[model samples]
Structure formats: structure tokens, C-alpha cells
Target: MTKMIVGLGNPGDRYDGTKHNMGFMALDLLAKEYQTDFKMEKTFIAEVAQTFVNGEKVFLVKPQTFMNESGRAVKPLLTYFNIDPEDLSVVFDDMDSPVGRVRLRQKGSSGGHNGIKSILTHVGTEHFNHVKIGIGRPKNGMKVVNHVLTKFDSEDNSEAQDGIFKAVDAIKYYIENNDFTKAMNKFN
Candidate 1:
């Protein structure tokens, strides 16, 4: 079965390397590991690259609708590709989990993430696959907006990188096995 792996992030250089863009970061690594470059698909308003992993066709996507309206791009791509929610996987940032922690789930609520919320709205279901790249909660006294947009400190940056890499591995495992429970058991 074909699968779509979406990386949700705001579109622009200003958001680059921020904690909120962990999804995009992980996609970049996954694409690089697959030896490909993203081509902007204006029809979907997203960057897309295609590759095969363990004989499964994988389409990597990065929505360009900013963080709040990512569904506009995601929903269209899912429909156009005729991919079921069961065959769709997404990678995104999560503040509740500690940095460097990556969790793969068959499905879940958005947990207050606007991007994931929008995606759920457009996709019309919560029963989809997801890989959450942990960004950690804001330190006391820091605002959520500021904390998510800010680059991590030197120490935390390394951990976040590790998390993204782990997410990449999880994606590969999920594609190869088509088993979220097994992938989560091994990687989460």
C-alpha cells in the first residue's frame, strides 16, 4: 500500500530551525537519507518528494499553509492521492513530551496543537498515524508562542536533533511493516 508521510510546519525562513518546525526538520532528514530533493507542488501548496522504502511507495510532504492552517494542504493531498487515513502518517511537534522523545501512535487527539487540530478537521478523522517530535514544554515564565518559535539552546538542540532522527527511523519502520503498534513498541 502507498503511504503519505506529512511533516507539518509553517512555511518560511523565519520559522526555520525553531522547535515548532521539528516536523519539517525530520522530513528534511528523511528526504536526504532517501537521496532526493523536495519539489514545490503548488496545487497542494506543499513541498513533496517521493521515494521507496522497503518497497513501499512513500510520499513525503511539507505543508506551506503556516502552522495554523496546515489542513488546507494536507487534506487536499490525502484526497488527491486517494490515501486512507490508515495509510497516512504525520510528523509534528509536541510540547508535552520531553525533548528527544519521539512517539509513534496509531491515532490521538491533537493535544492542543493548532496544526494537528487543523489536519484533523480537514482529514475528517482522528484515526490516523502520527509521529510526535517532542519539543518539551515552555520553561516557567516563557510564553508558548515565544518558546515554540525560539531556537533551542545548544544542549537542547542536540536532543531535539536526536528526536528527529529517531522519528525518521520510526517512519521507516512503519513503512516497512505497516504496523503502528509494532513500530511504536520498537521505537517509542
Candidate 2:
């Protein structure tokens, strides 16, 4: 049974609303809509919100650790909850996809996402579900780091919001049906 949903991002006012924090923003919206509150949990190095969906217990998590260290928190949570890799889902930003797109995967490599890389490194596997929210690429060949940390412009804000909502829907579908292919076909 799926037990944990982790959102990857850096923590701090400065990072809020940045493209890199899209995962956290999406998860926050989900928590708010579900009327759940995330409480600080040092053991997991994250803020966690608990709720039941379709009669299944779900842990909504936003790691407090910086982006590159996200896995440090995730590894322990999986171990503590006795959750297998298949039962975990991670949400994170992707620069390759357009701002309005969301991609869902059952299991795959990190695709060079530092946050995901960190998680995989700690957990020693890449076989886990993931929802990748698109933030769009830079105008030119700008560095990915700078591009991801930048805030969305007025033109991109609406698309970003759309992506977040779609991601939430995909998560819901995943929990309700355990059908990753359906979520991917519907959302991606």
C-alpha cells in the first residue's frame, strides 16, 4: 500500500514560489484542499500531513532539507514506515517539459534532478513513483540552476498553477486506483 508522498524543494522564504519549489507548492495546495496540516517532524527532516484517501492512510511530506539533500529525509521515512520503493511517490520540478505539463512515472532514473539524485543515492534505488512538474527551460542556454531558482514571469504563472493542479489530480488518481499508466496517460 502506498503510504508516503514526498515533495522536493529548498526551505526558506527566499525559495518560496520559485520554480524549484513547485513540488512543495503543489503539495501545499493538496494539503489545504484536504484540510490537513503539516507538522514538523525532525525524524523525517520534513513537515508531514496525515490524511485518509479512499480509506488508505497517506503521509504528505515536504522535506525541510535543501533540494540536493532531499533523499536524506526520504530514506528514513521509507524505512520507518516499512514502505517499499513502489509505495513511495515523489514530486519534483522538471525543466525539460513546458510549464503546463506534468509527467507521471512508475519508476525511473532521476534524469539528473539533484533532489531526486539525492533521494536515490540514499535509498540505493531509482524504482519509485514520481510526478514531475514542468517549469520550462531557460530562454537561451542559461544554466539550469539559475533557471530553476528564478520565479515564474506573469506569462508563466497561470501555466505553473495549471501544472500544480494537474499534479494533484494525478496523485489522487494514483492513490485511488494504483494505476500509474492511467495517471500518466491522463496527466502527461
Candidate 3:
């Protein structure tokens, strides 16, 4: 069963509310709904919250190592906990998927996501669970870097609010049942 959940995003005020930080935002909402709070942990380079979901211990982690190097925070946590790859689920933003859409996968390659690439390098495998939150591609052939770092405007923000909540619910369901298929069916 899954035990650790890591949300990938750059840390700090500058990235706040941007498309790339959607993972962090969704995880924060999940933590709040569970009545828990994250504490900064020096070793992991992330804010971590521990709680039980349906009697299973769950760790909610937000990497502080910036987006590209997110695995620096995740690898150690997995090692310390002795968690299997299947027990670690990463949530992160996806440029290809349309905004407000979510995709869940049992395991796969990073598909060019730097954060997931780093994690795969650290963990030595592509077999791990992931929750991909869509941020949508930018118009006019804009660079993905610029697109992801941009903040959502009013209309996008409204859509995101609802989307984030749905992602949170999906996480809860996954933790409780270890059923990614059910989660995708329900939330996708």
C-alpha cells in the first residue's frame, strides 16, 4: 500500500500561485482537510506532515529544493522509511494535459518533467505511482519554463480552486484504498 506522498514544486514566495506550484497547493489543501500541518525537516529539504488515513500512516511532503531537484528531498525520505517504490506517489504539474484535468498512473517514465526525472534518477526506476495535475500548454509556442512559472489569472484561478479540491479528494481515496484505478475513475 502507498505510504508516502510527495508534491513537486519550487519553494518560496516567488513561485506561489504559479502553475508549477499546483502540486504544492493541492497537497496543502489535503493536509488542511486532514487537520494536519507540515513541519520543516532539515534532512529532507521539505515540509512534511504525518498522519493516518483510514489507519494507514501517510507522509505528505513538499520539496524545498526547487522544482528540478525535487528528488533530493524525496529519495532520502523513502530510504529512511524503507518504502517500496509502489508506496510512493508523486504529485506534480503537467504541461501537456489541459488545465483542471488530472491523470493518475501506476508507473512510467518522466515524459521530460525535470522533477520526475530527478526522482527516477535517485530511485533507479520508473516504476512508481504519480498524480499529474494539468496546467495546460501556453499559446504562441511560448517556452514551457515561462508558462509553468506564470501565475493564474482570475478565470484560471476559479477553475484551479475546484480542480485542486478534486485532486485532494483523489489523494485521500488513494491512501485509504491503495486503489489508483478507482481514484482515476472517480477523479479523472
Candidate 4:
């Protein structure tokens, strides 16, 4: 069976390296590690790359739609590929955990994440997998929007990179084992 691994983030150079794009960053790293590259697929409204893990077919996707509207791209891709929602895994930034932390869950609420919210609405389920890289909450009364869009400060960059790498490893583990619970037990 084939599986879809989605990384949540806004498209364009403007969004690169921002705290909100941790998912994209992790996917990029995964692609490079696997010696593959992403290509934009207009029909899917996403940048997609194909790779394999433990002999299983896998697709790595980065939705081209902006963050809040990610499902606009995701749902179509899922339908086109005839993939079950349970076979989908999502990577995204999470403010609920501190930097350098990676968390895994089989399913859960969006936790105020707009990108995940979009997926839940369009995909119509909370039963997929989540690989979250922590960005930590904004401090000193900073606005949430401002914090997400902004690049990580110098103090946070190293930690964020650690989190992203950990997230990628977690995804690899999940895809190879085909067991979300095992991945969660090992990584979370």
C-alpha cells in the first residue's frame, strides 16, 4: 500500500525558514537524505516527491496553498491517490512544546493550529498521524501571527533545527514500521 506524508507550511521563498514552516523544512531534509527532489504538481496544488521506505511506496507532499488553506491542496491529493486518511501522516510546527522537542500522536484536535484545522475539515477525520516540532509560544506579549511568520531568533535556531531533524527521523520510523503506536512509543 502507498502512504502520503504531508508537511504543512506556506509556499514561496517568503515563508522559508520561518517558525511556521518547520514541516516544510523537515520534508526538505527528508527528500535530500533520500536523494530525491520535489516538483510542483499543479493538479494537486502541491510540491510532491516520491520515495520509498522499507519497500513501501511513499509520497512526500508540501501543499502549495498558503498555511490556513492547506486542505485545499491536501484533500485533492488524497482523493487522487486513492489513499485512506489513516495512511496519511502530517508534520507541523507546534507551539505547545518547547523548542528542540518533537511529539507524536496517532490523532488529536488541531490544538489551535490553522493548517491542521484545515486538514481536519477537508479530510473529515482526526484519525491520522501527527509529527509535531515545537516552536514554543511567543513571549513578552508577542502576537501569535507575528511569532509564526517571523524567522526563529538566533537563540532558538539551533534548538529548532534539532527538533526538525528529530521530526524527520520520527517520520522515517513511522513509514518503515507502518505502526503509529510504535513510532509514538519510540519517539514521543
The candidate that wins on lDDT is 4
Error of 3 at 99 (Å): 0.5
State the lDDT of candidate 4 residue by residue for 1-188, as single tens digits.
Answer: 99999999998899899999999999999999888899999988999999987888899999999999999999999999899999999999999999879999989999999999999999999999899999999989999999999998999999999998889888888888888899999999
Candidate 2 regions with alpha-carbon error over 4 angstroms: none
lDDT tens digits, residue span 130-178, model 2: 8999998897788888899989999999999999999999998887887
Q: What is the C-alpha lDDT of each candidate?
A: 0.91, 0.89, 0.87, 0.93
Could you arrange the candidates by lDDT from highest to lowest?
Answer: 4, 1, 2, 3
TM for every model, in the order presented, reads: 0.97, 0.95, 0.95, 0.98
How many angstroms is residue 162 displaced in model 3 relative to the true structure, after the best TM-score fit?
2.1
Q: Rank the candidates by TM-score, best first.
A: 4, 1, 2, 3
The collision pairs in model 1 are none
Candidate 3 colliding pairs: none
Worst 10 contiguous positions by lDDT, candidate 2: 174-183
User: Highest TM-score: which candidate?
Assistant: 4
- Pairs with steric clashes in candidate 4: none
Candidate 1 lDDT, 65-139, residue by residue in tens = 898998899899988989888888889999999998998889999999999999999999998898998899998
Cα deviation at 74, candidate 1, in Å, is 0.8
1 versus 4: better lDDT goes to: 4
Instruction: Evaluate residue 144 in candidate 4 and report its C-alpha lDDT on the 0 to 100 scale.
Output: 95
